[model samples]
Target: MRGQFPRVFVLPTKLSPVELDRIEGSVAELTWDAAEAQVFVGKISRRERALFELRRLKVLTTETSQPMRDHRSGIPLVKGAKTSTRRNGTDGPHQYQDTDSAGHDEFQPLRPGHIQVVRLQWLEDSLDAGAVLSTSNYLLYEGIKVENDPQPALAPTQVSQASTDDIAHETSNRPPESSQYSAPSQRLRQGSRERRTSSGGRSIAPQRPVLVHETTSEHDLPLPPIPAFLHTTYSCQRPTPVTTPNAGFVEELKKVRELRLLEGDSIGVRAYSTSIATLAAYPHVLQSSFEVSRLPGCGLKIAELYQHWREHGSLAEAVEGSKNERLAVLKLFYDIWGVGDTTAREFYNKGWRDLDDIVEFNWGHLSRVQQIGVKFYDDFKLKIPRSEVEEIGSVILGHAQAIDGGFQMVIVGGYRRGKAQSGDVDVVLSHPDETKTLRFVEKIVRALEKSEHITHTLTLSVRNSERGQTALPWKGEGRHGSGFDTLDKALVVWKDPEHAKSPHRRVDIIITPWKTAGCAVLGWSGGTTFQRDLRRYCKAEKGLKFDSSGIRSRSDGSWMDVETDPELGPAPDMVTAEKRVFQALDLPYRPPEERCTG
Candidate 1:
């Protein structure tokens, strides 16, 4: 049954996004293009409504006069006024011999290109029966494919600034004129009309910039081949450059993903993450919806979004979310240093619409860290310049070395990934001797605080040192709490005393044993998606558990010697050690710049 089902297309009309995704996933052979579907499944029941849906999809068809017959049984497969049932009350193979004036029994001879519009129940019943059920009881209309009438020429104002080749590529991949799909340009025209009528001739919001013209030819010059690493589902295996041709579109998607996060839609967040990772790795600028549909993790719905974005210069949902008051408030709380989605919703539920509200009404109820977050919310929101980030790292490293001259540090996080500025500073400090690192987090924070460089300690954890600084056993998920990893660390607020006007900044100083410095650096350097996939890749493929603390064999929970080679011995520097760790994991060494799987 895996691939036996007909090519099916589920209409989005009158269905929730969750419902649409569920039905799409249940289909064994779901086709993105309506023109390729042998069956159209939707909630619609009336003949006129079904025909309207077909017209919306640009499916031109001629209604058949005769009832459809099952080729295998040579029996009429049309439902009558009454359905036959077995003794057990299950659907029976009832055949219709006569029809009313409306031709309820009328259906086209189902063939390769002909289509049958059926109620959603057909899918439900087929799954319940564990077989493809006959459509007799569910059929609403049937039609033979027909050639599409000519579309009118585009008006002068309707032309886009896209390259000729891109337009040609879009045209070449378009479904047949009378097929079960409308051209993107045609859809945009219809969408414009709908918006104008619904909103009294004005757009709901200002649109984004038009898609810039692309010069690459889809035919004369081939699309850059997908990198071999991208073939795998793990994003850590792929190279996602910091700058991509699709960065603008990716940012648009990130906004929607962020909205989902604020709305507490975990599934939606994960779905968007996968799509964003895939698109981030794609080298070419998208030219058509078909291009989007073919990419890994991107499906028909995402492709439709790409089409809409290309035509409208913005996603409707993203624009609408930006203007949503609830979402806007949630985003405000979520942006605080120590607040998460759950806490953001909690704040909103308490009627704390802004930082002022929280400060005035719920100041005592907030955690110490969250209270600090609200107090310095404006300062924390300010982007830390690369120069400032480097200065901050230098100051922290200076303090660590003051305690012990052997201390060495590597600034990880976005700064190492080639960002012009970072939201915060993250530096991993280590020493050549194990004794120097044990319980080092407290010493470092105390030193910074004494020097007036540290304003507040958000949270300090010595879990790694308490657990003897070894990789904890892999007890699977839910075994770990908010910290997730057991690296000794300090989350602190820092401000330069040298410059009184400087903004307060968030800084994380992590202390790792010199042996696992590679793991610490690797884990913290990559983007969120890159780090997630790295762990997943390790667990699924290498039978190992990975965290910023260290990597351990899942089979026996023993630490793997990833930083040392039998010939070269231990790596001399943190960066070199990180390269060795990648090699030991059987992963290609991706530079920090190439690990931006956002």
Candidate 2:
């Protein structure tokens, strides 16, 4: 065993289908700017050795059905138990008093229905053996000998626990029927929702299907034999307009989108987005799942969902999510800025009931941006009228011109795309001088605040793309990665100075070099799915990286020439570069107004 595992190894972990799918996409399948995640299982000793040496890889025991025991007391925690917090070093109401081998209390109370995360204490490869150990109250999973176990059986297994007749009622292992599914669902949420892309403030609401580059024909319903042209995979090929053909049906799909997003399945979210866009643009009412399957984006899964919609009138996942307390709380909490579904789950685990609860006890742990978000959640939820956005835009533009006469700003997002009401305003600014753009966010924000219009600044990030200039790189660092390529960005809470106590609105001020300003305008002017597909198209087909800042040839890692002059004068013209990006990628030039991927 020692030789086989190098005296230290990670066990062959049990994984879910979704987990496998997430880890499955690697260099060949994944996009350029996605987080690194993958999983494979086989001979335990062999596989663990390969991964353990990587140092950064995290090892976790897939959640088991019954509650597991603590290493110290060998006593199992109740189903869904929470950790006891101490005030002034005194135990809270639900404290676990289990004692250790030395007759001292020691436990890292395992909550029921959640997987136990184990930390390795020493170099040892016996993780897959049996009977977990405890150091500082850690509970280890004692692996069973799987000699030649089939792969399928290794999926989340039902852990066995001794009869809890002797256990106290408050700390029993028996769980409700709902708890059984809760574990996997929470795991899925945990695995997926941590690093999700925000899907709002993109373009006009109720987006229609995409107007493809060269396609002449449009989707005509109530006819036999669907045209081959109507079934192209690309969203750009189809004419998706703002008129929602199937609003009720699309609403159901939105729930799926919500679940996928909450689970952190960005790819899945994208998959649904394509289908949603196609269906939204569909000119005719979808009468059946068979009809849905015939559409451009729908495949087996989407077809099944359509079938469910026809027969049951709703999705099973939607029904389940509506009932899951945890999911509901997570959905509500996820609205806060800088707070993802993962952070929401952590808050739930801490017994945080509402925003006030979080504020009362957990204010310090939250990022400064998130605190601002919490303070103005209700105000941010209120939509901004086109007139209001225009006023805000004019104010920002006027402020910029005051600071620098040549600075120009355009409202992108929903307002630029002609939405009646928008969740937030996304304004893209540009200046001829790259130096001026460097600290443009700071100056503009200062100017806006002076007008008493910019109420609060949520986040300010300036690009210090000079390699090795910033602190340790975050996960999934790439030109088009998690945060996306940009010059400088400021997320702020805003309200009109005239309406002093009026509802606050979310505003994103994006400062870009004149060279890549067009792309920035194009990327930020979104119907969420439209931007997603744009990135997908650029990456998969062209092997070029496309972000707001500029396009980079994936081959050479050098930026495409969107700039006219490298000298410190006015930045390169984006009008030329915008058209050039389309030409270079061999795609039809789509004007900002036509780009909507909601």
Candidate 3:
């Protein structure tokens, strides 16, 4: 394979320094001088983008009218062939042809002052096939070189968003050369349940249909109007349905985000969070990088990733991150019920690679809660089905009712937000009488513990009741900090005696006064990002303090009556009370299913 490649310049755009080094190291004639290169290799997918990169690099060139062709067959390299159909000469009539470069006659020499821009995948496939593969399907541009006036280096910036604002389109302007690539007849292959990329270790889900309408221009898919609420900075103000067209991509991004958290990259975690939320709200299946770049938080880097995913059926970085040895160990510890990312790293630093390591070496040093987590590590990892979550909620309600018949409960958490399964069960319990709600969590826990339904109690707090059951004062984070909710609550482990084989599940019981029951449900129902934004919206827009306990004036400590109606009087039920909270806050009411902002 030595000296088989021509003078090549690996464009640094969209590639990390390490990745650039890896690609450059493999090329026999890697050149830093753009003028001396015969081929420009990059991850770029479009001819326009290739030209933009050349201009950014200050390489002057004019488009060539004659297309590049194969040397042996003298056939013009076709455009618009899908990458999936480009396997080595077996899959179809137009399957990729491998160009063996054992001698000089196998390859056409570059014409004087001419250059071809090819996809980075061309090099990878050539190396894999042990020959220089024909670049017909991978070629993005061909041009004649010219001298440019020397100018100061330009700051690297992507194409202007204004020019790239189109919603979705194919990679090229030319019509497909084969029927398989035609827009109208092309169908999404529902291949295997999961397919691993040729690179290995990368598992991708089934392909989704490219959402577009058949038209003559091909690049003119009408843009769906951006939802009005998407313009708002706060995710709490918008509706986020659980099911989205870009869910597979979002899931891959989440894995990367989790890796960032484990690695303690706070900025990266927040950046990925914003991008994931934006994609989760997107309604259309993406067809182009331009569509992704136009999204609120997604820019060129994310757009490039979308292009890569479309071509390879998976994100390369995400696959590698999932296989990282350090991250895998960190995730094992992070998944423990009582351990967080910080604690996970702490365990890793202590040479604890798995649960057995912690139990064998550091069992005596482990906290009681963490020890319990280690004991039931596998059991806690199991997801609780919706039916079992409901049954657990019923058992808690039944025990609460045993203490007092007036107790009311509403299942919250992921169950309320339309998840098929949940990691835990959360329920808000209230009584019509505020007096009964005071110190009520203790009674409910005691009753459940007596019945053997409650196995372990992680925490119990009654801060709100002890402080007269009022909303906590609105102080800046510097003063009050992001403390736990002031409401009375109990975190416990539960199991069903009827199903002896049932896995132990985590359950939370929240006690709220009747006046603030709505606040309790609203606070616990939405996703983590949705709740964080709700507090932010209150402080920045509404000038109030929000928590599960209640809402209060920021300037003063007086509790705000968001659950009461001015004309109709107090809310008659909890659901109405929640709606009244939305009304009082001047926010449009969002149903539980629409609060899945994650």
Q: Rate the local accuracy (lDDT) of all candidates.
A: 0.72, 0.54, 0.70
Per-residue error at 156 for model 3, in Å? 23
Question: Candidates sorted by TM-score, descending order?
Answer: 1, 3, 2
Evaluated against the true structure, the overall lDDT of model 2 is 0.54
User: Taking the tens digit of each residue's C-alpha lDDT, what string does model 2 give over 177-275?
Assistant: 222212221222122222211221111111111211211232333545554434544555445555566877788988878876665445456556766
Leading candidate by TM-score:
1
What lDDT score goes with residue 404 in model 3?
Answer: 86
Off by over 4 Å in 1: 1-224, 481-483
> Could you give the candidate ranking by lDDT, starting with the highest?
1, 3, 2
Q: What is the C-alpha RMSD of each candidate to the true structure, in Å?
A: 12.6, 16.9, 19.3
By TM-score, how accurate is candidate 1? 0.67
> On residues 340-390, what C-alpha lDDT tens digit does candidate 1 reach at each position?
988887777666678989889988888999889888989999998899999
Worst window of 10 by summed lDDT in candidate 1: 197-206
Q: Is candidate 1 or candidate 2 better by lDDT?
A: 1
